[model samples]
Target: MRYALMTLIAVSLAGCTRAPAPVADVVAVVSASLPSDPADAAWNAAPEHVAKLLLQDLVEPRLQAVSTPDVRVRAFTAGQEIALRLEWPDATINDLPAAGRFNDACAVQVPLKPAAAVPDPQMGMAGNGVAISFWRADWQATVKGRGDTIREIYPNALIDHYPFDAPSLEKGSAAQQKMATEYAPAEGAGNRRGGARTTAVEDLIAEGPGTLHPAPAAISRGSGVRTPTGWAVVITRPLPDGLSPTSPSQIAFAVWEGSKQESGARKMRTGWIPISIREDQP
Candidate 1:
């Protein structure tokens, strides 16, 4: 009995000595200067650190888990702006938008209030809403040309004459504006009041799972570049006022793989992750 007790104690001690898993450090390094447009070189020059994140499949509405499970994130801040760089491996680039087709996309979610309690990572909760800045591959195409135009997507197709493109400039503008509203209702009725614009990313705010609403694009902006193996995306916005250098904040992320036909409730996502703002480096 004495020997058995001694062995048990030794085993317990061994178990206690096991080291915990290493925690990933994610910080938004402060910079004296940051470019308005984040090019590859700009991100490379900025002091950055990466965090490894694992995303679980959200299978409530449907089974949508085609995206890669691994995600890497880096970030930096300069002046009043903060930029987050997210990269993940994807075997294919799915930007084509057609019947039953979807686009590859990624999003970054941040709480509206700097110190607010963590809301639902899916979006947010009631008054604890989070700002979601979503970047889609299909949308990026529009930034370069008239992506929605039939001629742009389908060059081989024969000439298409629309009644809207009449000889009269005023009449043509009006017709096009009217068509824009019918095509994109989410853009609201205000788009008709002005000339059309090529929208890039989607800016939204959600209080809960189904409370997502379009937010002003002026709040957040993002850009992305596709690589051979995957995608590298940058999401940038002005820092929230009253945020202190050492204040601890939280950010969450989600990804959609169009090649896997992932959409809606079906995707891979991570819960809120703690982040801090570091003092600016000279």
Candidate 2:
């Protein structure tokens, strides 16, 4: 009777034990061409993975609370190029840029090393760097034919004459160019922020926190659309060094809610999530 009771107790305890959380996989479907549009019908064939986000409270200027709880991610690959579509909920559309104001944005990060030796998802470590493909709603607006001029951003605000718009100077004259450069020093200095952007996505690299910078070459392209509920963005870039149909990899995500004053490190982020590529199909 004692042995039977002990066996019954052990079985009950085993049944009550909790199971480990299942790892989310972002499987990349093979396609003939990568889609640049976030809402392209081609994306429907790919499976969606919900990546739960966490507050970035590990460093200073951190996110104290969770603004975006999660993001829906989908991936597609064509030859050596890969594209990721990220969808998340945001009630408001915050695209205009101004002092004390930030734009809604999302970024995808992948390690530079092989999958066997993955780097820390917090932008990676000193030697183990990561490549980041960032998409901003404001940049998307510009690419979608929205003007970036001060007048466009603030129609009611009064403004004096701009030297670049002076009619007396020839359209391509050196004097006119010099005056334009003087008025827009950031654009004159080749800063990405002030110049006209051709795409919504920017390729960047980071070794760790506080080390993010533009990549030597911009090899990424993307687009973002404002849905009724929120934003859906598609970011495409050259496949990383070691990712293959059979070889799996990892990815991380970060989302900034402009309305919530989320910027820099003050945003919701995710740790490394497993990802795999699928074979090409007819």
Candidate 3:
């Protein structure tokens, strides 16, 4: 059933022709951070794209209420790396789970090929693939405050004996992390037992719906923070080696607000937007 629904989504997104972003609206990425201190200056100073996203109910796994309506994107490029900062407003803060539910999230999607007709915005279509960098609010909370831990997520849960934290061992916190690696190497470097994760951001690629998978060790990284109004996220990647110097590339965006039960194919998303090198922009 899941596979069938995913196929439907890919076909639907493919049939819907998205308008290409105009040249005037192309985001200009600069050579360096505008301010000396990244924190001292508001990151919104960069070229902006205000996207009006729509609910993802056109396919399967639909949702309601939790859709974030507006997404503000600011972008900049410094030397080899390009960064995008995304912002959206939501009244409820949904970083933690209630019952068995999940937390809020967002992502930035860009096509792997530079000059081709942009891939289907709802993941991708057929052989054309899109690479995505995801940011989850729950992971951000874990990285901050007390660090990622199972106890943190499930406050009342009890543990008999955690192997990572043997009282007799002098290594203390580091011991458990090593034990975690030994136990679940796929879990990566971390002391927390399933609270959040080592990295709040994840890199994934999709050739079509239901085909989302880990990217090929690509160089992409990012971070995010939540506020009373909404979320602020930043994603960075190196400029592709063979990108055409004259043509504008494509990028897309999506948001998943967990508080309103947005998950899977349920969330708000946008189609392709144009992006170009700062030096080339007229």
lDDT of each: 0.68, 0.85, 0.69
Candidate 2 overall Cα lDDT vs. reference? 0.85
- Residue 177's lDDT within candidate 2 is 79
Backbone clash numbers for all candidates listed: 1, 0, 1
- Give model 1 RMSD, 1 decimal: 10.9
Model 3 stretches with alpha carbons more than 4 Å out: 1-26, 34-42, 64-66, 97-99, 162-196, 240-245, 280-282
Descending-lDDT candidate ranking: 2, 3, 1
Q: Which model is ahead, 1 or 2, in terms of TM-score?
A: 2
Q: Is candidate 1 or candidate 2 better by lDDT?
A: 2
**Can you list the residue pairs that collide in candidate 1?**
124-207
Q: Select the stronger candidate by lDDT from 2 and 3.
A: 2
If ranked by TM-score, best first, what sequence of candidates would result?
2, 1, 3
Give the per-residue lDDT digits (tens) of candidate 2, residues 1-282. 999999999999887634222235888878888988887877767778889999987789888878999999888899999999899999988888888888999999999778467888888878999999988888888887887678767889787887687889998789997888888878777776844578888889998999998899998898888888899999899888788888888889999999998988998999999888977421
Determine the backbone clash count of candidate 1: 1
RMSD to truth, every model: 10.9, 10.1, 13.5
